[model samples]
Target: MSQAITFKNRVWENAGLLLFPDNFDEKKTYPAIISIHPIGSCKEQTSSNVYGKALAAAGFVVLAIDAAFQGESGGEPRFIEDPYERVEDIRCAVDYLVTLPYVEENRIGILGICGGGAYALNAAMTERRLKAVVSITGVNFGRLLRDGFAGGTPVESLEAVAKQRTAEARGAALFVNNMLPASVEDGKKAGIEDIDVLEATDYYKTPRGRQPNGATSVLFSRLSTGLGWDAFHLAEVLLTQPILVVVGDKPGGFGAYRDGFEIVRRAKSEKKELLAVKGQSHYDLYDKPEAVSQALEKAIPFFREHL
Candidate 1:
């Protein structure tokens, strides 16, 4: 059974759903995993809930949470996606898990999707309490936003974004990214034919995977700050826990992770693996049954052995 729950301010007051295995025994402790959502996404998204429930069904307690300042979580200046704060949110979730008598504090693990995957790695870099980590279609948002997805955007636009940040600091309204074109015609007019962005659009803008609070738009100031972050920051040394990175075999499908698998490779952990799903796109793994099943096949045993 899954139950809605809240954790008081350790980093932020976070709202999430906790899933328990069937025939759960509260008197006994169980291994637990934290399911983190993608950038601009919430716990209600498919990545969080789908994996959370699956991990629960696999005999582990799972907690899927909205990041600080997003979804049901409380924070100031809403919708700002800060990578540092997100790493802290994962750590705070760990703090909450340790307090639950039914959770094995020493057996905690984490699974992150898209940008959340990077943040999870950042958390695992320092949070030794996390025994294992899993990243699916992981993206270092800072690099992607600055360099552009598959280098789709001109590098000159980064300098433009920097200028916009100065204007915002001078009392201008927050500059936000125009994620969707005004219409399909507008998208065509702008030549926004990138397959990755198009697939993401279909998933978030249409009923295929839409949620009320899941906005594709992001504050430019957030991007400016995020650009300075390296999800693999000091990872080669600090990241000793086992990690599993899952990506799509289809080219242009997994975005940065396709080529950036090298970043995850930098981890010093002896038991890390990068598993690519054959014929699947990054977004396909979001809710597609076959793709998700293939992912869990590797993930379950990785955690089973490590956690």
Candidate 2:
């Protein structure tokens, strides 16, 4: 069963869905996992519906959260998608988890799916309390948005985004952005040919993965915030915790496949491992039973041995 909860982070309160093992006992401390949701997603989605529930059933206390500025959480200038704030949110989630007497403070692990996967890796670099980390179909979001897999966006584009930021600072309304196309057909009509993005439309725009509190809108100024951000920066020296990155061979248009491999290549952790699932696309791992099972099969043991 899941419980609705809220916790403080700076000036805002983040909403979360907490799950405990079916046989949870108050007398014993249990290993915990923080399952972070993807961009534009809330705790009710895959973060809880897929990984959160599964990990909890596997004897872990899982906490899946809705990031500030979106979902049911509290923050101003909503839908910011600021990567630094996202990292801070993960750290705050850790703060909340450690307060529970039934949670093993030193035995905590973190799991991030899709865009959240990037934030998890970034947060783990300095947050040593998180003993282990997992990134499922992880995307170094800032890098992906800046590079777009082929070549980086021009500096002029960043200048334009900065200009828009200045306009917003001058009291202009925040620029609104739709995170996804209305449907798969609209995505195709808009010239999106990547299998991962189209499948994302299928998931987020349809009943398959949609949630009542979920939304596809975000502030356009996030482009300026993440223009030069790199979630994996400094990971080579500071990311000493055990980490597991899972990616599908078919990265499709999003290119998280490359990001996953690069993280493993640069991480200093001796316990790092990368699981490349054959033939699966990025979205395939979101809710597909066969793909999710393959990931958990490896992830559970990795967390078991490390946490």
Candidate 3:
């Protein structure tokens, strides 16, 4: 069973989907998992069809949320994917979960996809309420853009773009080019052979994984805040909670996940482990049945043991 719910994040109201196991008993308290979608993604993309609902079906309560400033959540400067605010939103979801009579407050865990995965780890650093965390095909946005994807970007280019975006951020015409191809022809025109990039464009630009509230473009202002932030900052000492890092082994697109998983491996948790799903790209893990099933197999047991 699933129910629609809303909660407040300071003065702003946040909307979410709360999922319960089949044959759920209101009188029994069950373990809960807070499922966070990718950047520029909403609950409908993750919870409605994938991780959130699957985990709930495996006998846990799951709360899939629309981050503040995106999706159905309430916030100003829409489409701003601020890392700090995203981390707080995870904490806020935990707060809402703890208040429910049927949720096991001390047995709560969190799972984040793509950029959301980075924020989940960031939140677990300070918010000890989450007993375990799972990051799937995670990317540390700060490191990804500032340093460039896979290998590092040229320092001069990075600094130049930051300077330009920082200056334009305060102005009213805060528009930037959409990250994904605007159409299928655009993706084909780019001649990018990488399946991850190609699939992402298809997912967002086409009806395959599109959500009305999701966008491929974000406020240029986000660069000002996101560039300076580090997703794995202080993870070595502060992220003591048990963590499971899952990634795809798609040859060319695997570096981002490997980088994040490596950083998370430095944490102090003795229970931490990394699982690589062979023959899949990052986007494949988002909705592909075999990949999703493989991930849930490891994730469900990890949460059961830790949470």
Candidates in order have lDDT scores of 0.81, 0.87, 0.81
RMSD of 3: 2.5
lDDT of 3 by residue, 175-239 (tens): 55466777767878888676766888878877889889777566654565676788888888898
lDDT minimum window of 10 residues, candidate 2: 148-157
- Model 3 lDDT vs. the true structure? 0.81
TM-score of each model, paired residue for residue: 0.91, 0.96, 0.92
TM-score winner, 2 or 3: 2
What's the lDDT for residue 122 in model 2? Answer: 90
Stretches of model 2 off by over 4 angstroms after superposition? 148-154
On lDDT, the leading prediction is 2
Q: What is the lDDT of candidate 1?
A: 0.81
Among these predictions, the greatest TM-score belongs to: 2
Error of 1 at 252 (Å): 2.4
Predicted structure 2, TM vs. truth: 0.96
lDDT of 3 at 284: 81
By lDDT, the candidates rank as 2, 3, 1
